[model samples]
Target: MLYQSFREYAQGAAKIGIGLGVISILARWVTGITIFASPEALVKYGIFGGIGYALMGAIALMAFGWLGKRVRKEFGDGLTIGDFFQFKLHRVGYWMMIAILLITSIEGLFTQGMAAGVLVNILFGIPISIGMLCFFLFCVVYVGFGGIVLIQRLAFVQVICMFAAAILIPLYFFIAKGVENVYQGIRLYHPYLLVLNNHEGLFFMCTGLFIGFGQVFVDQATWQRLYMLEGKKIVPTFLLSGLIWATVPLAFSSLIMVVIFTGSFNNIYSLLFDLIRKIDTIFLLVLFVLCSFGAVTSAFGAGLHSMISLIAGNVYPLLKPDANERQKMRMGYMLAIAIGVLSIVLTFFFTPTLLELLFFFGIIYAALIVPLLFIVFSKGKVDNFIPLCALIGLVAGYTSRYKLGNLDAVWVSMMVSSLLVIVHWGSKFIKKQLGNH
Candidate 1:
């Protein structure tokens, strides 16, 4: 009896742990763009740039735990972060925050849609519009009908497939070609990639970190995970996921490097196509397919799920004000389908190169980072004008990019907003003191 009970307990614990781990990987780490974007950075900027890309994502995931703990403490049993914000913030402030959230979330889905279109083009040689529709259909069915429980279940399979590919594919290549050959090949074909301290490269790296922190902290999918996991499980899950997630990008980036070590390509997409052509081994092709699909689906699923939470908790509630859980869930499902379809349509026409796309949005993400950190970490309510400061800084930063360049634009924007908010608050404090006197 004792032995049986112990076995049963262990099995149950394993079930929950595995479920949470899958969710961590799928909900936070995996994304359609992550697969395409990280390797693209590697090729454009160098291997170090790829490493920077991966580190940005991992760092963001680890830091989110701090936000998670505070959120749960402030609003226990909440299904979404918006729920907490809606309750804590007054009407004007709540709407302001919600508007920002919706814009960011939509941007995220738009990116995901682009990745899905690209993946479909690669996998099936189909029109991007049709492929995008298929992507939308899958997300709608899984997230809408399956709910959180099914989403979590699918995540486990996705995580397992991702790890297997990240591990085995790299291992096979290193073993077959030998590490020295790959290294020498990289040196011969792309010598600049080895130079880590290049001035332009280092500058981008620092700015990338700031943009990374903002994107991770403000992302709704990540916030949803914060409440779903056991409180103690939150930090460790993020830390472990970060460590494991680091390996995927490094491995995939290196895989691309191995392909290019022999010759040049037209662009990132060309490199991907070339890699596909060069790999005649059926097993390796299957592995690549699984890896690619896993990355895209994980990202799409997380984005869809979080989008639902925002609509259900933030937008719908404002209109209804007295919705029950079932009504909220129904609205959530409807919103997911509508947004998914819209993103798919938008993806059909997006033409920017991957790095350019990231840089374009990186300004907005970086501008919001400090303001959010202030909101979460500050002792009391922040300066009301701080949100507007971020908006102004974002516009200013991107507009000045031609004059200052991308890296400098980020630094300047962050500094300018910080100063403006501080000055704004100081004047308010001075007036309050004069009134008291």
Candidate 2:
């Protein structure tokens, strides 16, 4: 169906049921980056990487159920995350977050585009630039024009394919290869993977929890999804989605182990390509490609659509005071194309490993988690310092990178921001005591 109003374009008038609601949330979170990055994590941190990565996201989703409950209680209606942000934030904080949201949204799309570029290059012998361009354009057409109705409809199908691949491929690999053969191969080549006491892996799980919380809290797609569900279903839907979503990463991680123990691979992408090339089963190979493609497009589409909805609903009216719903919807379509172009361009020039990309974004996610928690849970108008805490902590985190490793820098950002939040609350209490005197 053709989308006329911006709300219809964004969320299909918030009429989604618990079943599709779960699928939509799954599509948003089980993204291209998650699929590729989980395997990469397994390669680096061994068994801990696979399970820890999956567990981190599962916990984040479950935790968001709590935040979602409180947020709906306070202000139950909204089109985008920006609607909630505008209601809670003063002018300065509102604009600061809007700017950050735009940046992070673009970063999200670029990362997905990178995954698509790599996949197409491996499978079809397409140039990375051209493949990414096609990916962006396809998303723009589907998400920009088809709107949330189409997104949800496609999400239902895409989700089934992804789960099928994650389950069937791993089950097939393990059964055919035999558990003993794979286990011996790993023990022979990478025995460290079996170590029960992996210090770095433990650290990754701990620090990764912070990143996961912040990411889910601040994510535009997730917040938009909050307003899309029934009031009673909010907590349970989010919690269940997290539990089921956890399986994809762990399964994908095991799927990669099918071949990686055979020989040394230079990087995750090469290892992924090798896995694909080694799979002699034709139907399984087809399923893998579809899974990869579905993951990338669904993720990119979600990010692209959320941003367009945010701008059309929250930002455009400020620029065009007299604009109507259709006009804003039109602007949303334009924004989708523009953002898609920008994402493809950036992905073309700025390429990083999936692990590197995650750590880099971790600073932003970590610093914002507490401040956003403040925005939702606190009473009265939130202080301007709430948003400033994120900005300041982000700078401190990235700046400290010279002296610290990537994960440590991310923790530094979270701590600094949390400290600022504490000071803000402490000062408020002190002023109340002074007034009593």
Candidate 3:
């Protein structure tokens, strides 16, 4: 079921039709971070902030639909984002992109692994180490052994669990406690949540748009799915997936309101635990656990699979052009297992708050967005300076963070990259005009 042949194993079966395409994207994007991050936004920046969080993701995914169309029109036969970079970039630029993508993808896995540890610890009272090990092992087995087909099948089931929880959990809370009580409770205890005109919230929304655009635009997993889908289905699948995916963060944010209405908690996980206590039904509890676990695992699996694809498709081939299909498949499996182990180790040692982690990496996403966009839209191969632009932006962004703060650093990063690209293109345009004269 996983592989039709070695070729299929290397580059999926290309059998993810429209319906499966939507669900698979949904499963990948509707992540554990969304479950917690939406509520955290609401609590920190008010209602608008929460709405902004959902809007950023929805808009990003929808925007990718347009990019997907371009991708198919330009290079429909590509297997991975690495393939696109290989074609669009010089050797140095391609390697830079590959390295950046690998770092970010590893970070993605680490985040999901952390979320998995938290979920298992919360739900089953298991130690985080044991929980993380189990989660990593599960992903390694299925994704490493079964490839894209297995991941796609599991994605469908995971998405079903997510939708069930997103719809039912919030609805049940509203019915049981009543919206009026929830609203009144927020008014009495956390009135900031009700405020509509939060300037900070607006700032966050704008900056978040930059971060979101950068993230989805460069995500190898999203690009992999684009290749997996039928050519005609690409835009509609992403557009519909974005629309459906928005509801998840919206619903989960509302659920957070229900928890805070009762009382404030020490932290996000505590709030989650309190919400679990409020749900009197055992079935709902089980559903919530399944939903949370599924989200984490699905996301981790997607990241792992994409990383494997990038290595096998781009890195390994360059290293050993003589390697056969079976050899490539074996390398992918080994990489998956190695990544799983590394992710577990990292998750155990590092424990930053979710938003902190996001903002820290926000610098990279901000820096990458402009160059990646220029690469995609440019008619011909881009110069080596494009990747160098990203590198400089990253340096400037991080340097500015201590003085200006995280959000400002993101703006600086984006501005620096955009400025560099614009100047280079303009200079070239002027040179061409002078030559014509």
Candidate 4:
């Protein structure tokens, strides 16, 4: 039974063990965007680029395992990432972080909402608006009402759909088309894809590592999962999830390769359509639809739920410290619907390509990574200026975007934040020495 009690609704039945943790995390990470983006990375940066994308994600999640262990040790009993931020940061710092986190969570929801619309339009010839409306409505009903227990249960089914598509689709193409023919086709058409010494591919891989790290590190949904796991199981669960997650992008990218090796395509979406047409089997078509929809809905639902938790747990309590559990629960459910509707409206307006959207936010992720890591690893309360470091980085990063290009802007943002932190701390150390003298 899902959420049989109030306690179950609030915290789930019990701390998730390793197996469910891995599967649930997988469901969260194997997003609809990943299905498209993995292939896009392959087309843009070559075969190594695809592999790099997979590696970046795996490493980020594995690294989070280390952070998760530390966070649990520091704050063993917490409901959300906001709880951790409230403990670690001063009032102003905590507010700033909460603001940024809320925005990022909304952006995540919007992205998934957009993907759902796109997938439905492609698969069923429905209007994008109608597709998104139905998608968000379903997510709101299930996740908003059912809570974490229901989410975990649904996650198992979603992951099964994703795994089936990821494995069987690529495997079928390889066997039916013949591996040698595919290889020969690629060699003849896109020689760059095969080149080992691809400079652009290498650059993308390096930058992607930074983006991936920051994305996972600051993600509320991920942090929520970290809190949901048993103390001892945390590290192993994340590490195993990372390892398993790497294969998804790799497999999805290979499936794209099956499309590429056959003929020329205008864009990533076109290639996806071409692949679908080639598959030409109703069973595989149904599988792909389930996989895509599941990925998008699961991701959107996770983000929406986590955002509600942050608002209900952190924000509402600040306004009404004496609020009861029933009040908080009511606030969470109401906020979920509001956020779901907001995501649909935002998705309608924001029509950028997926990569464009990611790179635009890449600046933020790059800027946040160093400051966040410093906060996580610091032994004592960090200076409030540490959080300001993200603002400074964002300003500098965006200012340089036109001149330096998107990827370089990300590099600059990270460098600026890292420099500020070093200089700020170094000056403090010197002042201490001078005062002692």
lDDT of each: 0.72, 0.86, 0.86, 0.84
Q: Deviation in angstroms for 80 in model 4?
A: 0.8
Instruction: Say which candidate scores most in TM-score.
Output: 2
Residues 126-155 of candidate 1: C-alpha lDDT, one tens digit per residue: 877787788778877766655556666667
* Native-referenced Cα lDDT, model 2: 0.86
Candidates sorted by lDDT, best first: 2, 3, 4, 1
Model 3, 1-437: lDDT tens digits are 44655547545755567898899899899898888777888888898878889988899999999998898799987888999999899999999998889879877987787788877887778877788898888888878787777787889889989999999999999999999999999999999887777898889899989988988999999998888888888888989988998889899999988888976679987887787888899999889988988898888888888888888888888999999866887787787678667867876677776766778888999999989889999988999999989988988999999999998999999999989999988999999999999
lDDT of 2 by residue, 90-174 (tens): 9899999998888788778888888899899889889877899988888888886777887788788789889889888888889
lDDT of 4 by residue, 231-274 (tens): 99988999999999999989988887788886687987778778
Q: What TM-score against the true fold does each predicted structure earn?
A: 0.88, 0.97, 0.96, 0.95
Which parts of model 3 have CA positions greater than 4 angstroms off? Answer: 1-6
How many residue pairs clash in each candidate at the backbone level? 0, 0, 0, 0
What is residue 270's positional error in candidate 1, in angstroms? 0.9
Off by over 4 Å in 4: 1-10, 435-437
Q: Report model 4's TM-score to 2 decimal places.
A: 0.95
